[model samples]
Target: MPVRSPYPDVEIPEISLFDFLFTDFGGRDAEPALIDGGSGASISFAELRGMVEKIAAALAERGIAKGDVVGIFAPNTPYYAAVFHGILRANAIVTSANSLYSPGELAHQLTDSGAKLLFTVSPFLDRAAAAAEQAGLPADSIIVLDAAEGYTSLHDLWGTTAATPAQDTLPTDTAVLPYSSGTTGLAKGVILTHRNLVANLLQIQQMGTVTGDTRILAVLPFFHIYGMTVMMNQGLHANATVITMPKFDLPEFLRIIADHRIQRVYIAPPVAVALAKHPIVDQYDLSCIDIIFSGAAPLDAELGHAMGKRLGCTVLQGYGMTELSPVSHCMPDDRPDLDLNSSGFALPNIVCKLVDPETGEEVGPGGRGELWVKGPNVMVGYLNNPEATAITLDDEGYLHTGDVAEVTEDGVFSIVDRVKELIKYKGYQVPPAELEALLLTNPKIADAAVIGVRDDEGEEVPKAFVVLQDGVELSADDVMAFVAERIAPHKKVRVVEFIDVIPKSASGKILRKDLRAREAAKA
Candidate 1:
């Protein structure tokens, strides 16, 4: 039997994403919705709703119909929320691409997602144009977020009259296609339906994290699932004033928190580390902050507690994946007495179980196993990859999370380790396979294996073990520089070790455990 959520099931409405968010905005129309952290510009709820409809009409005018995949390849801005909902309102799927992706990386996602159109900012126009070209998308298919000399601004798409596209969207229809590498392999599109996103939003709302009066500081990148749901959607759903920062600059982050009197902050582990130890934090007044919630990756208990003490606020953590519509377990705001290390109880209507990996049997309370979950928040499937979908979601609809966790007697879940080979670098996923493939492209490199190794800052980084070809002369800096030019900065190879061979199994799979042991011996 699966462990049910301690909380009662909340009603999930069978409605489209747009209706769920904007249907009851009459009273809150004049309220501030999204405030630009940099320029102090803002959009009222009324203006946001109108812009969403106009952008939808613009998309329809451009011949974008239902089921078409549209890509957003820009950083977080107040306009991002408008464009994202507009794509959904047009009955199309929005696939958000990382702003830091290189041309090649961006091209792969665009081609794989079968994106018919792309929305990007002017700063990324050069790479976006190159990627669009590589993906066989014409120049006209690209729209700039900010108006450029030859290109039209996204604002231009809005018309004075609100036009609603044909209402063909179902609750189960895929709404967002955020890509994830699942447990292993290259990144694949995760199919989150309208119901999946709405269910998770409702589930999170029941947790009582965000209230109507909550002032949120959103510095987390909207491209990632964590920020999309927690910071952007949840903040809007609760009618909170969300201050949007395009990127995370520590000094700016502190200043905004102080200036805006932000009450709630949602961040990842690295930022938590900074808050705990950074000297600059003492320079600012963060007294208004009520809660600091950390997700995306694990937060060390010691660091979490330290940060709470330093800021005089409640520090909490949550757990989820891109395939789970991003949140399954979170520390409820009402339950501040729970252990900071645990990810907290399963959200309402979510069923969680711990199963023995080798025996494939359910574990009792306190026994460790791969965490399996069944909930409305679980994704529909992986786009264009039925095999991966089948592997992740079983016939009974349970998602194998690939995370080894233990549930306490009182129903708290704590992640112990990962059963998969993917590395979490500062909350950003760095798949070893993606890095190894790039390493093999070098003429001097004969064979390579990549693994996550801890740096002095206690953060995970990709470390490459290279076996060079005969008579090849290459320095570690040369190898690192080679990869840095071709991939995103976060995925760059930070540490390199020359080895005689890359240990592998008989089936030719890389023995990462053996490599990890060797690294442990060195430490």
Candidate 2:
């Protein structure tokens, strides 16, 4: 028997995401819905809705329509939200690419998702243009949110005399396509439908409190499912103000929380390290913060406790993945007393099972096993990859989350380790296969395998186990620099060790567990 959520199930309404989020403002039309923390500019609820309508009309004028996939490859900003909803309001699908993606990386998503157009900021125009050309999208399809030399601007997208397009999307229609590595391999688009997103919003609502008075901080990139659903959409669903930061900077993050009087902050474990131990954190007054919620990776209880004690706020943690629409378990607002090490209880409408991977038997409370989740918030499937989809989601409607977990009889779940080969670096997914493939491209390297290992600070970083070609010389930094130049910063090879051979199975699969054992022995 599967363990169910402790909380009452939430009613997931049958509606499109646009209608679900934008249909009501509840008389706070004049209140700020989104604030740009860097520039201090804001967009009120009324203004944002108006912007959405005009942008949608402009997109329709440019031939975007139902079933069309549009890409948003920009950072967190009030305009990012506007364009995101505008794509949906235009009855088009959104494939949000990571803001840190290199041109090649962005092109992969664009080609894979079949995106017709891409929305980006002026600062990212160079990369956007390169990716667009590589993906076979015309230059005219690149729209800059702000000023650019010759590209279409958001200003151009506005002031359309044409009416906004009618909403043709159904609850079951695909909405946003955020790519994830899932259990392993290269990034694949996670097919989250309108209902999947809406269901997650409602399910999260039953687990936590986010009133209109709450001010959520969004420093994590909006491309990741954690920030997309929990920080961006959840803030909108509650009609609360959300403060946006394009990237994480310690002093800047501290200042934004103090200056904005932000009540809630959603961060990964790494940020907690900065908040707890960084000397600059003491200079800022963070007394206004009410809750500091951590996700994406496991949070150390001691670190969480230290951060909360320092800031005089409650520290909480949750467990999720891209395939579960990102959240199936979290600590409730009222249950701060639950072990900070645990992910608290399963969220409403989530049914969880722990199964022994070796024996194919269900494991109860005290036993460790892989977690399986079934819920309304689960994704439909991976886009255009039925084989990968079948491997992740089983016939029983459960998503076979590759993370190993343990649960108590009371329904509390704690993610202890990952069964997948992907490494979590500062909350970003770094797929080993992607890195291994990149390493093989180097002429001096004969073979390579990448795995996660703890650095001095205890954060996970990708370490390359390499075999060099005979008579060739390459330093550790040389290997790191080669990979850093070719991939996004997060996927950079941090540590490198030249070895004679990388352990492999008979079928030619890199035995990651053997590499992990070697790492353990070294430690």
Q: Where in model 1 is the C-alpha error above 4 Å?
A: 159-162
Candidate 2 residue-wise lDDT, 108-147, digit = tens: 9999999999999988988999999999999999999888
Best by lDDT: 2
* Model 1 per-residue lDDT tens digits across residues 41-63: 99998899888888898898888
TM-score of 2: 0.99
Model 1 lDDT, residue 221, Cα? 85
Model 2 clashing residue pairs (backbone): none
Model 2, residue 481: what's the lDDT?
95
Lowest lDDT sum, 10 consecutive residues, model 1, at 155-164
| Model 2 ranges with Cα > 4 A deviation | none
For all candidates, the clash counts are 0, 0
